[model samples]
Target: EDLIAIINQYGGAIPETYGVPVEEIQKGIKSGVRKVNIDTDNRLAITAAIREAAVKDPKNFDPRHFLKPSIKYMKQVCLDRYQQFGTAGQASTIKQIPLDEFAAKYASGELTAVAKKAVTA
Candidate 1:
């Protein structure tokens, strides 16, 4: 949660409108919300960057020069996603949490799970 708070405070990936504010998201991050799913934003970023590059250099012949900025833009998008998920510079933190342990716990029904769960009940 503390990490989430930090990311949110830094204006990272999390959207601003919700019942639970940025503080809550931060708390959730602190409470072991490790994986944040993001796809659409990435797609948009890549598409927009490519379109911009194309518009800027419509008849350019050199693939390397033309694609370089697009690649950089995509990298920035990924970095932004990392910031939003509180996973930037998280290599050491990940090493601390053993994947095997998480898998065992999940298998033993000791871990709760939800992926955008919805209910009509």
Candidate 2:
């Protein structure tokens, strides 16, 4: 609760330099904290999966043997984070712009034309 207290006291004005526990991640999110790093947890999950896969088949020389489990574990972590952040079903909320059109506009300078015109005027 100490971490939550500090965050609440500062109103999340300060960026947390240390890793926040998973149990407290939701608290941070609810408190209006914009970004949270869960790299450590994901790394731990990947490392553990790799170790287990390697040990289970000591004679296996193919990289795919270990990578398969690693991918599964990493994917699970990513999905969990997406759900926790309330972005699991938010794809429709994003503007559906085509990549090629965006690239064309960028290349033609149309994307920033208004800003350029404003600056010159």
Candidate 3:
């Protein structure tokens, strides 16, 4: 999954050698990616926003006013990405998986035990 995220972040246009591979990150979004990390984008957006703000108002002393638009823009970008990634309707699917059940299975190292056992047996 970490590799997938790294690939999604920097893997520029799919190579012809791969013969038209499906974008796994996009597929993951469709299945479910509850916590999508946007550190780089967030940092870049905020930095750009701050630089612009500072340039426009060199002596801007009010932190709240200076950063308000930046925060709003960052949030809007995050929302747009979430929608584009097909995660907008994830809540419904997420609700189907009970948290307790998921946690228990996860803790027991049996999240996919049944399938594994069936295959190995």
Candidate 4:
């Protein structure tokens, strides 16, 4: 709603749209969805920020004036998604593999992909 409001306030047009509900996404996570791609959400947030900045300051030609808010908005989206997806604070769990060991494994073909079980779809 905020996105649509801002876009309309800036005289831009987008058809009214809806996305998967947050509750549904949370359910997906509970059902073993490890990752959810959300670039569209990020883009919408960024575009809203840019449109708002441009509309609020029409005479301001400085790009930084527009970009700073977009960066802030984007960061908020990323942080929100991380928290929602339960990925926040989980980066610390990744064990750091040494570069030499990683390279040796790659050279020995130990990094080869394991075939997946075929899906009916």
Q: Whose lDDT is greatest here?
A: 4
* lDDT against true structure, model 3: 0.57
TM per candidate: 0.47, 0.58, 0.50, 0.77
Q: What is the C-alpha lDDT profile of model 3 across 1-104, one tens digit per residue?
A: 12223233443232222222226656655554335566666655565566556666788878875588669667866786677666666776755768899899
Model 2 TM-score, 2 decimals: 0.58
Pairs of residues clashing in candidate 3: none
Per-residue lDDT tens digits for candidate 1, residues 1-121, read: 2323333444445443334444565666776665554455444444555555565677876767546765676677678767765678977764565889979989998887656533322
List clash counts for every candidate, in order: 4, 0, 0, 0
Residue 57, model 2: Cα distance from true site in angstroms = 0.4
- RMSD per prediction, one decimal? 10.8, 11.6, 9.9, 3.7
Over the full model, what C-alpha lDDT does candidate 1 score relative to the true structure? Answer: 0.58
lDDT for model 4 comes to 0.83
For residues 15-101, write the lDDT of model 4, one tens digit per residue.
778898778998877776666988888888878988999988999999999899888888888898888877888888999999999
Give the clashing residue pairs of candidate 4, or none.
none
| lDDT for residue 33 in candidate 3, whole number 0-100 | 39
Comparing candidate 1 with candidate 2, which one achieves the higher lDDT? 2
How many angstroms is residue 72 displaced in model 3 relative to the true structure, after the best TM-score fit? 1.5
